[model samples]
Target: MTRLGYQIPNFTYPGIAADQLFDTVVAQAREADASGFDTVLVMDHFYQLPILGTPDEPMIEAYTLLSALAQHTSKVRLSALVTGNTYRNPTLLAKTVTALDIVSGGRGQLGIGAGWYELEHDSLGYEFGTFTDRFEKLEEALQIILGMLDGKRPSLDGRRYKVSDALNVPAPLSKIPVMIGGGGEKKTLRMVAQYADESNLICAVEDIGRKLDALAAHCEALGRDRSEITVSLQTSACVAPTHDEAVADFEAYLQRNPAAEVRRAGTVVGDPDEVAARFADLLATGVDGVTVNAPANGHVPGRVGLLGQTLAPLIG
Candidate 1:
């Protein structure tokens, strides 16, 4: 069955305080759990944009917030939308997941991707290598994570990372799901075919078919069943009592960020039934799940709640 998840906006909102944002997220998560949402995801970014509030705006750490979420909600999986590979060592990253899984009673999924924000890396003093180099590092990190999870003391010699006989004690209680993000037709899709248990893409109605076709081809090349990989899409959403009201809100959101055309695509805007039909169409494309990116702050909490409570039943 297809599942629905939420991507909590950790950035500040126009008139809301930082603490208020976090509280609202926790409240929404609780509501989602009660409303039968499958997972709650947080983005892995250090700074926020103007639409997301401000770059220097108050932001919370992804894993830290997730740890708190582990305590606050039950029956919902928790993860970062996609953790940047450059942010932490593979072994350390594995340990973090292991701990989160333990704390959340085996409801942790690690969503990781090749780092893209070069500005964050530069500001944080992380070595920002070429894109190809970053992919190489990500590939190595995947190997290390999988190896350690399999009870093997892994040793790796790679261009970006070199590790020898690394051990992760207290192995995860369950085989944590490994979700790889990005829809790059080449290396990223190849990696997903070879290793990832789940794969996520930014939803573009026109491009999704082609991307799915590419992923199927990659799976064929690796002799893997395409059915084994759970396909997911990340898209924005806004719901209200009527289509006009929701579309108006969505248009207002678009007005705030004219440059992010992609973000505006595949956005489900309407009443519960309309949103459910939109999501059902996406599910028909072999998408096993979706992560809905709600507007930052509590401005749209009721909309999110309505989606979880109303659309979820129809789609599920």
Candidate 2:
């Protein structure tokens, strides 16, 4: 199981020229690789997320970044935190993930979701449909993608999508973990029970128990053991040497991005020891692990290292 994951969502670091941006990203990725993080993740969005920055902020292509990071980091699994199902053709996504797995020596996971972010869709000309429409498309996409990942040519002429014996060549060198990210009870959890190898639960800590209960019910209804799927929280950890310092770090983050707190996903903020205590509470809720983005200063040199060091032992 991947007990710890380091997510890099903020690419706009102050004072880092555009030409040197990826170098900074690579540096932090190497830090995560050397630290105890088992995975390195990036958001799959064409624009900067509202909670992170303005639309014009520097946001790179997810798969491109992952393929490049694979050369720099050996230990951490590479992936988009959650690939928007609406972003690409299902067969193309399957092929892309396969190539990433081979390039990374089989260290990759496919984290996908029912696409959100209406702005991205409306701006980029991707269909911005209702929630139901997106989920339905996601279900069909999954049906097509899973077969391809399994080395089977899948053809589907379904209500929402159609594929004609779509071929995926050069099968994955190793099993690529499939992680679905979201906390929708009826549709998302049901799909997770049926399809996913991992579930990255997205909810505040206070609500984790309820979400877990919902997921368990879905699993039971589907005749799948709850333990069969590895579960991790999509969360944030803001840590420093002291609680005050942690508070200051979060303030710094807010200054950097004034729209919203990405940490709202589920946050544990404090000194390392205090962070450990909060981590214990999150784990006690039955989640197998956590995927964390320290948006506060995560782009700063050595900042991700501090987070990994603070968290590794608790997860280890």
Candidate 3:
């Protein structure tokens, strides 16, 4: 059985008071922690994503929010769904994550990816380069972070970044799992096989088994064991007392965001029993865990608890 995680992508939900934005996010995080959720994640973006809201929608700094949430919760692991590698220097990012681990009592996971949001980069004064440039930076950044994690003082003059005896002291209490998010098989999954502790992918559920097969091939080519890397999927989840309401909610989401097209295999929407049945198929695809985004109803008081009651037992 795979583990269960939750992601909160939208902070500007209907009826949430403006002044109570963090308050609302904290409430949801607390609920998930108390529930059976093992990990809680947020986006690492400066602006609201198009699929979720407009440019001005509420968006908090990823590390700042996670640090504050850590003080309020005790059980769940915390991280950005995938921190944009270009947003900060690799050494600085490592230090920030280490600090988060210290504050969270070692319940920190580092989720990173090659940045894709150009609008936020342009608006926030970040240098937005070509796709190849971004990937190069990500690859080099990983080298630096991994070196630091092993207590090495890495000095690299890479194409995208230069570091001088970069050291990450006061290291995490435990070995922080590095979660690489993306499914670009050639580069991303290859990198995962080389370095990542976990890999998170959002793809059509039908493709999951195939993706896992690809990952295994990458592992074999690199002489790495496939079982050493945990595979987690990020998908939409809707839990209701009846299948009809759950499907209705999923439909409402699609209607609100036409770009958010998803295959039925990638979505979980139904009553407890129905949800469990759907989840079984997903787990069968060799996924070791899941991080579901239920932004629509996650903040609704007992909604997260209800989801845990229904799905936690079914999850690994």
Best by lDDT: 2
- Could you estimate the TM-score for every candidate? 0.91, 0.95, 0.93
Output the better candidate (1/2) by TM-score.
Answer: 2
What local distance difference test score does each model get?
Answer: 0.80, 0.87, 0.84
Stretches off by above 4 angstroms in model 3 are 244-266
Report the poorest 10 consecutive residues by lDDT, candidate 2. Answer: 260-269
Clash count per candidate: 0, 0, 1
Model 1 gets an lDDT of 0.80
Root-mean-square deviation of every model: 2.4, 1.7, 2.2
TM-score of candidate 3 to 2 decimals = 0.93
- In terms of TM-score, which candidate is strongest? 2
Q: Write the per-residue lDDT of candidate 1 for residues 1-316, one digit (tens) a residue.
A: 1257788764545556766777767887887777767888888878764445556766678898898999999889998889999999999998898888889998988999999888788888877799988999999999999888767899988777788998988888888888899999998989999989888887466788888999999999999999998888887778787888887877776676554445565566777788778878877776777777767222665666777876576454
Ranking by TM-score: 2, 3, 1
Better of 1 and 3 by lDDT: 3
